[model samples]
Target: MRRKQDKNIENKQREEETIPKKISYAEILELKKPDERKLFLRKTFLLIGLILFVLSIILFVFINTLVGLGLFLLSIWVISKYWTLQDHLLRESVYFHPKYQEFRETPTKKIQFFNFSFSRFIATVIMISLIIWNINTFGLELGHVGDTGHWWNLGALTWAYPLAIPLAILSLGLVGYIVIHPNLTIIYESENLYHIYEIRLFSPWLTEIPKNNIEAIRLHNSKNGPQWLYAVILFYIILLFKSGIALIEHPFQTNYIHSVHLIITASLTLLSIIILIAKQHCYFEIVTSDRLYEMWFDPALLHKRKMENIANFFCIEPIARDQHGFFDPLPKKSVNYDDQTRELLISTSRSYFRLCFGLFLIFIGIYSIFSYSLLGEFTAYTCLSYGFIVFFKGIKEDFSDKNNIIIEIDRENKQFKQKRIFSRILEYHFFNNLKSLQLHENTDKSPQYYPPKLDIFDIAGVIAIIFFIVQEYVYQIMVWAPKNIDFQNILVMLFELSIIITLIYLIIRPVDTINVGTKTIDNYIIQLPSLFRYSEKNGERNNFILSNVYKSKETKSFIKKRIILIIITISISAIIAVIDIFQFLP
Candidate 1:
């Protein structure tokens, strides 16, 4: 009986695993003829071309006349081609999927109202206010006979002031139109589930998902804080440019420019506030499943196919105490989702705009360095110093690998050895025994995991030497002196050289030891006198003595070297200083 039950369950599972067939577009457009679709595309193309042509004409007439007119016609031609290509692609897509139909048979009533009222009102208000402000401040200049000492006196502002406002208004209106349009739709249907999307002019349309198609549903944050901040800064800069133009055109009309500035500043400031509010509310949430995922921002939401998604979902783990009663591990878990998902978040966050802003800043920095005489040398020195230090540190660490030596004592013999081991050595032993040895691997723990051969003092000395060299070069290039180099500079250089030499000697010294066995013995009792002392009594081992050999002969040699170098360095510095002082006095 149990066997029969298990067989039934297995059969049911197999039946449930069947994949659903996708719908085709040809079935969807069967209600309308091919000729009608072609006609509709033609009209859309013509409309788009006409709009582009009109915009071009207006811009051309207002700006450079002939050049404007030429560009205007060219833009119209380009827009026409763009529309035709878009139409062709859309038709091709629809033909390939005949069964696939739009989610909505008719446009939503809410969208129509939004388009006619809210969008139009906002656009009109913005357009009218901009026109009024520009005319009152800059338009008056065309009729004025005398110079008003305004930025209108400048050629660029004179041309830009009239063109920018209308263009901005037009862009806003277009965005609004895209949001409100209702004919566009997306449909998703499965064996048991159905999804429908009514596409508006403002955002992409999405369809419903089949329950079986969903693999797993997970939450994701799409907002990139850094990218958002960069975008805000960029917009602020653009507004500042507009304000600059206004300032140039009407130098005396501070009130008009100030108002414009206030408006732009307020809008941007409000946007930042909104972003902060959203972050507090966790406004960026993405619901991802196997078949599809939906990204929801405050004002907009989008759904994309699972195959077409690309996003980086960071899995943030909450703080937890380990068995050792210590809270240490805190790391974000991350995975790369599909590219479509990533792009969706990136587009909404205005990540590309942020990148452009970064590029702009880099260009500005470069320009400032080259164009400003006062900053040229300082910038050059700073960049050179940073580059040299980083390069030297990398090279020193790489070369110091040869200095690392690991000695493994037999487990049985470890009890016989007696030495006051340094804390560093103890740590090295603990890590080597407890954790897997990571020599060349660049893992998360690599930075903390010290290689066996490299000594701490050697590393420190190398760093110090690099710093001294860099400083010496900088002094040579920047500071001017008499026929003889400055005594202070010479002193600094000599002191650095002395330290480097001392460090080198300390690193190269051999390990000290003493043998305790007779000449005939093959395995002599090798006693490391610096670290340990063992006594043999009645042919048996007695108490083992331990010593801190690190501070003995090897350390003394290093210290002596340092002292000698310091004295020599000081003498050289003193001689140079005396020469410099005498030369000045003469």
Candidate 2:
């Protein structure tokens, strides 16, 4: 028996010169989803955020009374308007689709995980183990249970026997369920249709997209912040380790074979360093007409046969940038547009973890300042502006240079149309006019020590001068100082030296540039710091150019001059070193 086709589905099939089994509903209606762009939430995060938010409101209201009322209303407005954390879209319990005639269809294939896996279970266990390890890193005294002595270590759960133990037990149940099930995906497919079923903690509902509705599949690297920051962190960790060893100058090599807390902190730092080294940028992105599906995986570990199967099954090519993050372009004689304009849909959605963290920090900072710290003292120093800085950084991920885009390339008409929905930006260009435009790509050498905010050498000179100055005073005066003072002062002086060294190290970092400009146009260059690649035919591109990451010289000379600081610090240091060596000064 033949299935009935809906109007919208029928029309799509008819255009492609093929007919599909009909359905009662004409068009596949996409359910309205949560505004996931602004806020962040996963399984248990929303509850935690809600509790923190309530606590903050209570503290403010109790203290400010009248003013707190207005602040509360403002908070409500702000949260609702922008960053109100919400849960993932929970799909309906059931769905309507083509009948389950798996045996009847030709070449009916069911593809998913090669087998059930405990990878997720293992990862979850490791994460929870780390959490418990850190929890016990510091000393704690849990209150006594009846006449019993204080609970120690893992026994701390007994203090809150009523709620804590119950909650812990409930958490264990959830973890057990997750460990058993993990996340599963099953895609049932034939020559004409694809039915996808995803079983995840957050994505429990199963559904499918129309086969013809699939627009494109893109591959992206999860590259992060500037190189300078990475270098700084690496050096800082090394310096800290050195400092710790210096603190225990005695024979204590095996003491910490160290604190559990120090071990925990070191483990976290090492994890961060490992992330810095292995930048996991490979995510296979599948964009449908109305929705997007993503699989974040390490490309190196992805099965080659499976990847080929996906490509062959979809009847489409996967678009990815070259290692440098550029794309191969298309030729002049592109597909005949006829009466059709090949439309390209591009996504600019980013991870929202930072944005959520920033908002949470703002709430915590406000509560801390209002409840405990003096408003007058805080206002005077203004040192707590970091919360705002983090907030801005978080938002930057969303409102970056490249917004979600829809492009129509009419090579037949030699025309191009670009539009961004959220930004309401529209532009028109011509392919012929762009013929002379070469894709401009530039990359820097390996990451170095400092940012390109200023000249790196100048910063170095300044540090040198400051170090000599601090040392000269110590050398000249330490003759009369006690042994303890001398030792302590030397440590303090080295500490001061490290700070200056970092300051200059940051100033002198290299900054390469990437830009898009036309020789035919005026002095116009749009920096492509955030742009990975551009091509006329995005899906089936041929000619190519790309970059992974690039820092610009544009912001390097913001202050324009570091000469005075460099010259003064360097000259003073050099003169003192020379004089001391020659014993020219007493």
Candidate 3:
């Protein structure tokens, strides 16, 4: 009886433990499946907001101002509720119990200063201050005259205020959301011989692979990070300058002092440029065996490379410094690398190119503003010539990859086929019998696959070609044709026709190449060939094979040609401008 009683107690305890475990597992599952209740609440609020906004507009048109104002306020409340609910849903989705596991294992000592709670608090405070200032200045404009001690007699405020205020609020919210959201961080645990992917919103996933899987691991400067700040600043300055110019031309007949505005605008632009340059230099990447890790102006880059008994690798640190003031220097920075090689240092070269292009565009805009007719004619001719050059170059490179090895993999049948290609029209079949095709590389020994012949006078191209051909004809007709046709009228019609044709062709031309893939009905069968490459045995001549199409030097040469063509086009335009100016001289 004692033994039975002890067994029963043990069973009861086990049952109690199992019940909680099952309940906890169920809760986790529910969390994983997206919170539908929050979504539904958000949808309800959105619908209510939309209805209120529409009703407010109708009430404003038919009823009194008080009813319209009340409805508008109600709409705003509904919209705010919708946004709050949506944000709550995102937070719930991104912050689950499982996600905290990653932080638990990572050493607290390695955490960067910027990643701390204090840094986030400071950023949030600054953002909030900016928001408050913007609202005080712009939100007051939404109210009626004397509503907020501001008098504005713009009748468009009824619609504009509602739309613009919400847009501004949404924009600010999006920026905050992006800043707060955690990004996926991949860490190389050399000791484990595996890659650790700490997904920002989820538990870490680990993948183990042989050393051969890693092609190279190197610390290179992030192309996007530093330049993004400058791009944003430049874009903002350009917009502001354009706005200021417009305002100066058509002075806003308001109480605001125009002189004060001009001074403010100039100061803002100067400050923005300086801040933009400062931010550009503080970005670097911490590359690992499997993925590129961007470590932005962080101290992690300064740490010495550590190699453990388990994972042995070298680190390559790629650094770029500003010399000769070609462009703004990125903030002084370095990042630790583990078993990686730096491929190239590109900061200075890319900056120089970007600066030159921007200045060229600005010069063109200025010239166009001053001498519209001459610049217009020269621009038209230059664009036409460049388009033809690109079309021919694309064809030439496409035809160059003819003889190379093609490896086609059939996933379904677990079979692979290797073939030597001699022509551009070669085809391969996957083991699952799906038609897998690729263009082989062009080589010296094989005939190249020429691009499909495009009709030189295809509808739009015909129009462009005819426009230039008939321009002289139109000029002649104006002098020799019937009295009913006015000379200037004919010339104008010809110009308009040419412009329309050129615009249509420019709009329709494919800016980049297209890739095609084939899948079986079951979706289990998939096949594709590896990239094309030149065969050493083929006398080093280039031909186009499906696999080697993009890897060829011909492709690089083509890109170089396009760039050179652009330079030549610009030079030609300048020369034409000089000639035109000389003709116009008294």
Return whichever of 1 and 2 wins on TM-score: 2
lDDT tens readout by residue for model 1, 98-126: 23544322222211111122333343455
| Local accuracy by lDDT, each model | 0.34, 0.39, 0.36
* Between candidates 1 and 3, the TM-score winner: 3
How many residue pairs in model 3 have overlapping backbones?
35
Off by over 4 Å in 2: 1-107, 114-139, 142-181, 190-193, 201-204, 220-282, 288-291, 295-305, 317-586
Q: Give the 10-residue window scoring lowest on summed lDDT in candidate 2.
A: 424-433
What is the per-residue lDDT of model 3 for residues 367-401, given as tens digits with 9 covering 90 to 100? Answer: 44335432344333433333333332222222213
Q: Judging by lDDT, tell me the better candidate of 1 and 3.
A: 3
Residue 572 error, candidate 2, Å: 28
> What clash count goes with each model?
34, 21, 35
lDDT of 2 by residue, 1-586 (tens): 1344577677877775443343222233322345364234332344454554575588676766656566556555544533333322222222323344221123357766432223333433544554465344432345334322223344453322321232244336537755444455566674543556656653433444445544444433322323113323333333334444443554644444233333344445545433433342223545454556665432223444444445445533322222443422322222344534333434343434435544543454344344543122222112123223334333432333343433334444333333222221111121222222212322322111112332342343235435544444455354434444566656645654554454443344222211212223322222111223334335342222222222334333432345455656656766665667568445
Q: What is the TM-score ranking, best to worst?
A: 2, 3, 1
